[model samples]
Target: MPDAYFLPDYRTIRYCLMKHILHGFTLIEMAVVLVILAFLLGSLLMPMSEQMKQQKIRNTQQRLAELKETLIGFAIDKGRLPCPASTTNGLETAGCGDNTEGYFPWRTLSLNIRQDAWGHPF
Candidate 1:
């Protein structure tokens, strides 16, 4: 070699390093990333639907509590409790049990609880 120092400059070294590091992702790498994202997202969202169902159950219980309060208020206002309304037509046709335990009368109460969570009738 000629009498000369051959040290690489900082910019040359950086460019060479970046040439190796800044390449596009390979097909396998892309697929792996997609799979990892899907797994993470699925893991996050899997319990969300179950949580939503639990929220619905909580809401139904709240509605039931409100209905109870309304019924008690009505009983307090009137001398006797109102009869249970028909599930189909909402007409006051069903009588309460001997102790006044029965289905909630939606129509008589003028409440909007035709169906509970999971599409079941109240």
Candidate 2:
């Protein structure tokens, strides 16, 4: 071994240890990373949510079209527009049955309306 007097530099060793200790992430660094992640996630999800909404709208419109076609067909079949029934019994009533309830044709067309993706009156 070299002379015992030639000891390693403790100051440099302490400096290197301190540097390593201070090299960890700071609060600001973590906050910045979180902010970036949030932005990326928001950008990714926004288009997906919008696409889902558009799909729902398109599905609703398609269902409405089909309902209109069924209504027209029913009219042609009976030579008149469908009328609402007195009750769930599917009997014709004084006025048109609740078209909104899908009972205009004695609930026969309810299946068509229910097929819509959103399953709303529209």
Candidate 3:
């Protein structure tokens, strides 16, 4: 048989492959990216947290007002003030502690029981 075609140089191919293998992020670079992302996310979440707090405050105010109206209606219908509840669960319908006050839940109407976000009583 006659001489076959000469093969291309393998060294160049190996060098290019090595370069490609080295061209990627190191562990340190990946860690830095993660840290930056965490910082960005934390900063963004702060404002959202504040907004959520304000929303909660407004909701609490509205709910308290509604509770006040309900208590007033209950009193008018039954001819007595709504009795104070032992807790702030807001679902007490059978009076609190004892049956002395005609089954009125008043814990929702107390100014001292309710508190603002700053931990002060409403």
Candidate 4:
């Protein structure tokens, strides 16, 4: 066996141990970090989706208010309320006595709106 004098000292042993430990993060550590990042991103996205839905609702409400005002203005101008529009086209019908429910007369009103915020007919 070699003499004790030829063996590695305690300082050399400690240096080698620290070098290996400081090489890089382990696979398990990387996976844990990725999971934490995913959780953070998911939390942020949920509220953003909810905010988008709220904005759509607000837009729909504003459009409905505008339509009500426009209808009132039309009644004052023509001395009578406009007739409901036909299903095939958005034009006002000649007679409204038979129809209780129908499309809005956007064409006759000279309005460009054809649908609501959710892509449904006004």
The candidate that achieves the highest lDDT relative to the unseen native structure? 4
Give the C-alpha lDDT of model 2: 0.68
For model 3, what is the alpha-carbon lDDT of residue 1? Answer: 22
lDDT ranking from best to worst?
Answer: 4, 1, 2, 3
The alpha-carbon deviation from the true structure for residue 15 of candidate 1, after best TM-score superposition, in angstroms, is 20
Candidate 4 stretches with Cα past 4 Å from truth are: 1-25
Worst 10 residues of 4 by lDDT: 19-28
After best superposition, candidate 4 residue 101: deviation in angstroms? 2.2
What TM-score, to 2 decimals, does candidate 2 have?
0.63
Estimate candidate 4's alpha-carbon lDDT, on a 0 to 1 scale. Answer: 0.85
| Residue runs of model 3 more than 4 Å from their true location after superposition | 1-25, 77-79, 86-122
Q: What lDDT is obtained when candidate 1 is compared to the true structure? A: 0.74
Q: In model 1, where do residues sit more than 4 Å from their true spots? A: 1-25, 94-103
Clashing pairs for predicted structure model 4, backbone only = none
Q: What would the per-residue lDDT of candidate 3 be over residues 1-122, giving only the tens digit for each residue?
A: 23434665688899888777666546658888999999999999999999999987897787578667876777788797655544554334554454453322445444333555555433
Q: Give the TM-score ranking, best first.
A: 4, 2, 1, 3
lDDT per residue (tens digit) for residues 10-104 in model 2: 99999998787766646668889999999999999999999999998898788778878887888888797766544555544555443524343
Query: How far is 47's C-alpha from truth in model 2 (Å)?
Result: 0.8
Worst 10 contiguous positions by lDDT, candidate 3: 102-111
| Consecutive 10-residue window with the lowest summed lDDT within model 2 | 97-106
Q: Cα deviation in Å at residue 49, candidate 4? A: 1.0
